[model samples]
Target: MIIAVVDGMGGGIGAQIVSSLRDELPTYIDIYALGTNSIATSAMMKSHANKGATGENAIVTSSRKANIIVAPISAVMPNSMMGEVTCKISEAISDSEALKILLPIMPENISLVGLENKPLSLLIKDTIKVIKKEFNIK
Candidate 1:
C-alpha cells in the first residue's frame, strides 16, 4: 500500500508519524513523505520514508495517488499555521477519494508541541490502529 504523510514547514509531528510507522510497519507498505517545504520533507525522509516530495505540486500529486493520506486535523483548515497549508491543498486532499487518517490535535494557533489537550503519541498510535484495522494489516 502507498501511504503519504503530508506536513508543513515545522515537521515535528510529521517526522514522529513517519518514525513510528517505520518502526512498527517497515515492510510491505510504501511511505511517501509529502511536505510543503524541503525541511519538512527532509525530516520525514530521515525517518525512513521510501521517497520524498516537496511543495504544492508534490503535495497535490502524492495525495491524489496515495491509497492513504496521513496528516494532522489542522491540515483540513485553510488558515492553519499561518496559511502554510493553503485552502487549495486542503481541499484537494479532503475532496480526494483516498482515505485520510487525521490526528485529533489541531494546530490552530499554537506550536505542535505546545498543545496540552491530547498526547500526540497516543493520537498517532490510534491512527495507526485504525489504518491497520481498516486495511487488515496483520
Candidate 2:
C-alpha cells in the first residue's frame, strides 16, 4: 500500500507522521513524502519515507498513486501553510480517489467543528488505529 504524507513549511508535521508510520506500520507499505518545498521533503526523508517529492507538480503527480493520503487539514485548503500549499496541490489531493486521513491541527485562523482539542500524540495514535483497521493489520 502506498501512503502519502503531505506537509509544508518546516515539514515537522510530515516528519513526525512518516516516523510514526514507519514505526507502527508494516515495512512493506510504501511511504511517500509530498512536501510543498524541498526542506519539507528532506525532513520527511530523514524519517525514512520510501520516496520524496517537492512542490506543486510533485504533489499532484505523487498523490495519484497513494492509496491513502495522510496530512494536516490544511493540505486540502489552498493558500494554507502560510501560502505554501497552492491551489493546484489542494485540487489534486481533493480529487484523488485515495482515502484521506487529515489531522485536525491547523492554524488558529481555521476552526473545525465536531473535533475535540486533543493532544497531537493522541491524534496521531488515533490515525495509526485507522490505518491498522483499514488494512487489517495485526
Candidate 3:
C-alpha cells in the first residue's frame, strides 16, 4: 500500500510518524514523505520513508495516488505551516479520495473544541492504531 505522510516547517511530526510506521508496518508498504520544503523532506527521509518529495506539485500529485494520507489538520488549511501550505496544496489534499488520518494538531489561530490536547507521541500512537484497524494488521 502507498502511504503518504505530509508535513511542513521542521518536519518533526512527519519524521515521528514515518519512524513509527516504519517500525510497525510491513516492509512491503511504501511510505512517501511529502514536504513543503527540502528541509522537511530530508527530515522525514531520515526516518526511513521509502520515497521523498518536496514542493507543492510533488505533494499535490502524490496525494492523489496515495491509498492513505497522514498529516496534521493544518495541512488542509490554506496559508498554514507559517505559509508553507498554499491554497492549491490544501485543496488538492482535501479533495483527494485517499483515506485521511489527520493529527489533531492545528494552527495557532484555529482551535478544535473538546480535543484532549495530547502530546504528539500519543497522537502518533493513536494514528498507528487507526491504520492497523483499517488495514487489518495483526
Best by lDDT: 3
**lDDT per residue, candidate 3, 1-138, as tens digits?**
999999999999999999999998999999999999999999999999999999999999999999999999999999999999999999999999999999999888889999898999999999999989998987
Off by over 4 Å in 2: none
- In model 2, pairs of residues that clash are none
Q: Per-prediction RMSD in angstroms?
A: 3.4, 0.8, 0.6
lDDT for every model? 0.84, 0.93, 0.95
Which model, 1 or 2, shows the larger lDDT?
Answer: 2
- The TM-score ranking, best first, is 3, 2, 1
* Model 1 accuracy (lDDT, Cα): 0.84
Location of the lowest summed lDDT over 10 successive residues in candidate 3: 129-138
Better of 2 and 3 by TM-score: 3
How does each model score on TM-score? 0.89, 0.97, 0.98
Runs of candidate 3 exceeding 4 Å displacement: none
Quote the positional error of residue 20 for candidate 2 in Å.
0.5
For model 2, residues 9-84, the per-residue Cα lDDT tens digits are 9899999999999999999999999999999999999999999999999999988999999999999999998899
